[model samples]
Target chain A: MEQLKKAIRERGKVLSDEVLKVDTFLNHQVDTHLMAEVGKEFALRFKEDGITKVLTIESSGIAPSFMAATDLGVPLIFARKKKSLTLTDNLLVSQVYSFTKQQTNDISVSKDFLTEDDRVLIIDDFLANGQAAFGLIDIVKQAGAHVSGIGIVIEKSFQPGRVKLDEQGYRVESLARLHSLEDGKVTFLDETVSVQS
Target chain B: MEQLKKAIRERGKVLSDEVLKVDTFLNHQVDTHLMAEVGKEFALRFKEDGITKVLTIESSGIAPSFMAATDLGVPLIFARKKKSLTLTDNLLVSQVYSFTKQQTNDISVSKDFLTEDDRVLIIDDFLANGQAAFGLIDIVKQAGAHVSGIGIVIEKSFQPGRVKLDEQGYRVESLARLHSLEDGKVTFLDETVSVQS
Candidate 1:
C-alpha cells in the first residue's frame, strides 16, 4: 500500500476535475510490484470472507484483480467492454456509463461463471462515481452470488463512490484514499499511510 | 504452456466460425494460477530479449500481459480501445479492425510511457488476423520504440496471422499453435504440448 501511495505521489498526474493519471504505474502501464502489495492488502482485508471469484471490468481493473485473484487462489472474471464472439449467449448483463469516455457500455459475465454458490470479491484500480463497480456488483447479484467485499487500490473519496456503495450495503476497502485534488495538489485522507514515499 | 494448452483443449469450445472460446481460463474468466504459469513461460521465452516494457491491446490481452510483465519485472502498457479523459493529446495511435466486432477501433498509447530507448515485447491472448498486433507494433514504432518480440498464448495458424508477421520480419512466438480444428477436435502443431483433459 505504501508503494502504491508513493507511486501515486511520484508518478501520478492530477488533471482537471479530480482525474488522476497514473499511467506510469496503475492503469495504462501497470507496476506489478506495487500491485502485489495491493493484492496482499486486499487478501488480508477479506481473507475470512471465502471469496469464490474476483470480478472486475475490462482494461484497468484486470491487473489488480489478477494479483488479488491469485492471492485468493480464485478465478478472476473480467466483464468485457465489447461482446466478442467468445462470450456465451446466456449472460448477466449490466449497462454502465463511463463519464470519462462519455459513453454507455454493457459489461457482462457468463451465467455459467457466477452462481448462487459463489461469493465474489470486486476489485478495481480507481473508485470514481462507482459506475463500473456497481455494474460488476449487478452482474454478481444477477447470478445470485453474494458480494463478499469490494477492494480498490486507489479511491477518490471526494467523489460519491464509497458513499454510494456503502448505501448499497457493500463493504468497500481502498488502500489509498484521496481527500481532494484542488489546485493540482493531491491530499491523502491519511497521510501517515504514505509509507513508501 | 502445457497448462494453457490443456485449458484450451478442456474448457475451450470451438464455435462455427473457428472461434475457440477459452473464457474459463485465459480470457473472460481468468484462472490466476494458470496465468502465473503463462507468465512464467513468457518470462523464460523473452528473458534474453532485454525487454524494458510489455505491450498489448486492451481487454483479453491485459491479463496475459500482466502475468508476463510481472514475471519479467517490467512495465505493461496496453493500447486502449478508445480515448478516455485520462488520455492526453500526446499519443501514438493506430487503427485496428476487429472482424469479430465488425468495427474498426483506434488503439492509442500515451507518448510518455514509451520511448525510443525502450525495448518492447508485445503480448496478446490470441493471434488470428494479426490486425491488433500490427496496430500495437505501429504504435510502438510511432513512439520510436523497438519491438523486441511478439508473444502470443494461442495462435490460430489456420489464419493468416503468422504469414503477415513473418513477411513483416517480426519474431512471433506462440505457446500453442493450432494445426486444425476439424470435426471439433483441436490439434496442435507441437507434440510437446498436451491438453489437460
Candidate 2:
C-alpha cells in the first residue's frame, strides 16, 4: 500500500482538479511489478474468503484483475464493453455510464461463466463515481452468485463512490485512497489518522 | 504448449467453419494458471531479446501481455481503441479493420510510453488476419522503437496472418498453430511434420 502511494506521488499526473492521470504506470502503460504487489495485497486481504472467480470490466480492469486472479489462483471473467459475434444472448447485462467518455455502455458477461455456486471478487483500476463497480455487482447478482468483496487499486475518497458502496453493505478495500487533488496537489488519506478518526 | 493445445481441443468451441471460440479459457473467462504458463513460454522464447517493454491492443491482449511483461520484468503498454480524455494529441495512431466486427477502429498509444531506446515484444491473444498486429507494429515504428518479436497464443495457419508477417520479415512465435477448423472440428498443425515438410 505504501508502495502504491509512493508511485502515485512520484509518477501520477494531475490533469485537473477532477481528473488524476496515472496512465504513466497504472492504466495505459502498466507496471507489472507494482501490479503484482497490488494483486498480492488484494489476495492477502481476501485470502480467507472462498473466491471462485474475479470479475471486472473491460480495458483498464483486466490487468489488476488478471494479477489478483492469478495470485488468488482463480479464473477471471471480464465484462465486455461491446457485444461481439461470439457473445450470444446468454448473458447477464447491465448499463453503466462513463463520465469520462460521457456515454452509457452496456456491459455483459456470459451466463455460462458465473453461477450460484461461485463466489466473485470484483476488482477495478479506479473508483470514481462507482458506476462501473455497481454495474459489475448488478451482473453478479443477476447470475445468482455471491459478492465476496470488492478490491480497488485507487479510490477517490472525496467522491461518493466509497460512501455509496458502504451504504450498499459491501466490503470495499482500496490500495490507495485520494483525499483530494486540489490545486494540482494530490493528497492521500492517512490510514492511521482515518482509523483513529 | 501442450497444455494450450489440449485446452483448445477440449474447451474450444467451433461456432462455424471460420470462427473458433476459446473464450471458455482464453479471452472472456480466463484461466490465469494457463495464462501464466503462456507468459512463461513467451518469456522463454524471447529470453535473450532484451525487451524493455511489451505492447498489445486493449481488452483481450492485456491478459497475455501482462503475463509476458511480468515474467520478463518489464512494463506493458496497450493501445486504446478510442481516444479518451486522458489521451491527448501526444499519440501514434493507426487504423485497424476488424473482420469479425466488420468495422475499422483507430488504435493509439500514448507517446510517453514508447521511445526510440526501447525494444518491444508485441503479444496478442489471437493472430487471425494480422490487422491488429500490423497496426501495433506501425505504432511501434512511429515511436522509433524496435520490434524484437511477436508472440501469439493461437495462430490460424489457414489464415494469411502468419504468412503476411513472415513476408514482412517479423519473427513470430505462436504457442499453438491451427491447421484447420473444418466440420466443427479444430485440427492443429503437427510441429514435427510441419518442420520436416
Which residue pairs in candidate 2 collide? none
Off-target runs (Cα >4 Å) in candidate 1 are A192-197, B191-197
Judged by DockQ cut-offs, the docking class of candidate 2 is high
- lDDT, candidate 1, A1-197, per-residue tens: 67778888899999864788888887888887777678778988888999989998888888887888888899999887777766648889999988877889898888989999999999998898999999988898899989999999899999998999999888999999998888998888886355566
User: In angstroms, how far off is B43's CA in candidate 1?
Assistant: 0.8
Tens-digit lDDT track of model 1 for B61-125 = 88787878887898888888878776858989999998888889888999988999999999998
Model 2: DockQ against the native?
0.87
lDDT of 2 by residue, B1-197 (tens): 89999999999999988888989998899999898899889988998999999999988888877878998999999999998888878999999999998999999999989999999999999998999999999999999999999999999988999999999999999999998888999889884355554
The 10 consecutive residues of candidate 2 chain B with the worst lDDT sum are B188-197
TM-score of chain B of each: 0.93, 0.96
